[model samples]
Target: MKNANLFVDEAEIEVHSGTGGNGVVRFRREKFVSSGGPNGGDGGRGGDVILVADTNIGTLLDFKSARTIKAPSGAHGGSSNRKGASGEHIEIRVPIGTLVFEVGDTADVVELEESTAIVDLVEDGQRVVVARGGEGGLGNARFKTSTRQAPDFAKPGKPGQSRQLRLSLKLMADVGLVGFPNAGKSTLLRRISAARPRVANYPFTTLVPSLGVVERDDRRIVVADIPGLIEGASDGAGLGHQFLRHVERTRVLIHLLDLEAMIVEGRDLLADYDAIRRELGRYRPELLTRREIVVLSKGDLIHDESVVADLEASLAAREITVRRISAAASLGLDTLLLETFDAVYDARQEEEKRASEEARHHERVGRPGKI
Candidate 1:
């Protein structure tokens, strides 16, 4: 069986609203009465096509293939001055973190964040009428109100228009773990959380991103482990390399390094670290700017404590704090988890602080500077 790719957020689809019911022209006549007033009833309004956000959905694969969605049409009016029944509205459920954008626009119109969980339940349930139904036409009974004795004209219902939209989803997580294949990222994740990701003794074991919730003392955080990065991952070398975009939303990054791979490449731990950093810069320079924590995995493999000390000293010389841990042995896991969690939480707070300051600065400026 083929491995499932981690990212499938972006997709395009078309949605159309229902059309209004047609107006009717009729007259009420009895055996004794020769010319009775008009009694035509108005038509009911059409149903609206709406999109809702559902937390249960993780991928956009369903909407990716769907071509179009149409709503129901309203019923026609009756002769006994009875209005037609209105059509039922259609609701579409999408995953959270979905970004809604107009087809031609480069920016997004709506961003559904986890913080908007409450708003999502309310707004997502909301029925946005992309196409409005036409107003109901007046019945012939209205002709009796004025000088016109009999009205023969009635208005027809208007049709609804279609809209094209592009939607994309970005996975939300506190930290993103990145490294080459067989780097023990999955093992580390399994050790930290209850998630049982497939652990194998080969490369590319993880085809898709796996999310795990790490809970400590009632405080929980989410972490995502993505596919291993080959040389040209940014250029789509590996499966779902484009999924790298999802990591952009993370507050911090945990970089895993397998000591064996470094040794095989004829490079030390520091060299392997730089190589991975270079790849991240190539993919997205902004990623390099995120708060990063370096981890040396497979610590148990190093039999000599002196060798571990030497590696730690080498990284420390470069002003990098390297944490050593063996996920398989469950050694130093508690320290790693606590420190990483604290770092991520601090980074998020700092980012929010900087954003608030920037907003205040913009408010003070009020307008663009004359260039």
Candidate 2:
């Protein structure tokens, strides 16, 4: 949990619960008692393998080494009709927002697109039993009858269950950071939240998405640092589809454009914005209609401040409001936070309203008098 890998998003794991303890077959032969009745003890129940949604774990990397998770077996029964001790249940901790699917008997790899999720771990401290332990066996004493003076046989414990599971993490975020390579999205994320995503001058510094929680007043807003997108990314070029999958659940998009590129590389600011928009549309058209705030990042690199205003006005002409900020300079970040929080709040209200409406429409159409 301490050194959470910021990269791992999916994994395949196997889980096996413990087998129950065996029952004992013995007869009372103590203190001068002849032909004592059978007194074998029953076995204890086996342990269960539980799955817990832990916020401390950041990714699925925790399961990398623990492919086969197991629980302890119950203790064996003793003589004199003494019951065995039950095994302790074992818990496997995973990050929140993880989706679990049951894999086939012989499948080595998990294909999530073809399978339905068995559980969606969204809340911290949520738990589910992945593998149930075997039942305890009965002792010979339990099998004794009036006709039979004594029973010699004891029942054996049943074997535990084994199954393969697929884990997929879908980032649950209020805001998604999106841009081309080297657009300073990572830098902005660190500037805004405590998430330590890789930041560099090179392209694709953030190979995988990482989450950051931004606390404002009494509310918390989760922001996702989605990996950079490029042209033709929507069609699975350059791990586009993988990156786009994480973006589907975001309510707002913070589209960053590098002002440094505009000044040094003579890159078209409008073109950079358009390229990302096209990729989002191709991946999912709904993503194009999400609430977006365009920000011209790395404003500290530009000597003439008017150039930032000019770029802002250029986008404003197309009815797009923009924010100019430099993460290093700590400029305009507070305003951006306020705006993003407002957008998230509005979207949350709309979501609750729609859910309430659907709740009142649970009745089936053309059944009875319901419409």
Candidate 3:
């Protein structure tokens, strides 16, 4: 069996709406009546293809195998003035924050020159109609008029719509975790929330991003542990490049550092930090300006407090504060959580303020004579 919870962020599929049913031409033949009028019934309408956002679903893995989606066709009309039943609509459930885009003609073409923005599903239970069903045909009875006493012809049903679409899933979280491989990101996530991601003592252990919800004092905050990054990650060197977009919407970022790895590999802590920073800058310049907290993982392995103090001093010299925590030892986790909550709260406040200011500016600009 496949992993049901496997993380899949991107998918491409073909969607087709159901076609309308055909109308029937019939006439009533009674014993007493010489010329019975046309009594044919109208056909039923086709079904539509709808996309619904669901918070329970986390990935697009289900759509990977099922590439084509088709709705049921409508029923044909009956002979004795009986209308056919309409086809049932097909609703596909997807994860929240899923972006749907219309695909171009070519199969391999990922980006289209002129693409239509179908829908951006950001809220749970939100739905969008991707394809419209065909219209039903008119029966022969509808064609009877004063000029034409008995009409035998019936109108054909319109064809349904079909199109190819691309779905991209971006994780929605309040905080994002960023670091190199084996930086204890997975461990930290496990310590903070109930999400138990695959944890091992190796590099690239976490191949996919995992989300965890942290609740404190009736306040809930979602955190995403993004895959580890290496040099040239911005240039698509590792798995981090594939998941970098998931972190773009986070309000805060936690930069986890593996102090034990730096010590074992005889690497400078500042250099490692700078390398990650460079990758973030290369990928997106704005990511560098996002509010971030630096953390040193595996504090239990480091016996010398002076080493941590020196590293903290170096980071402080650059106007960056550092925090240390050991997930295995369950140390400093409470303080980390509290501090993270504070940072998240501040970031949210700032974002709300900026949005309010922008709304006011737009209102002022649109008023009266100000073009």
**Which residue pairs overlap in candidate 1's backbone?**
6-208, 6-209, 38-141
TM-score of each: 0.81, 0.86, 0.90
Model 1 lDDT tens row, 52-122: 77755667778866758787777777687777777677777776666655454533544433343222222
Across 162-278, the per-residue lDDT of candidate 3 in tens digits comes to 999999888889999999999999999998899888889888888888899999997789999888999999888977477888888788899988898867986678888999999
Highest TM-score against the true fold, candidate: 3
Model 1 weakest 10-residue run by lDDT: 116-125
For model 2, the local distance difference test gives: 0.84
TM-score, model 3 to reference: 0.90
lDDT of 2 by residue, 57-168 (tens): 7788867777898887777777899877877899989888889888886455534652367788888999999889887787888888998779998987777878889888
Reference-based TM-score, model 2: 0.86
Cα lDDT, all candidates:
0.73, 0.84, 0.85
What's the C-alpha lDDT at position 287 in model 3?
88
Candidate 3 lDDT trough over 10 residues, lowest sum:
109-118
If ranked by lDDT, best first, what sequence of candidates would result? 3, 2, 1
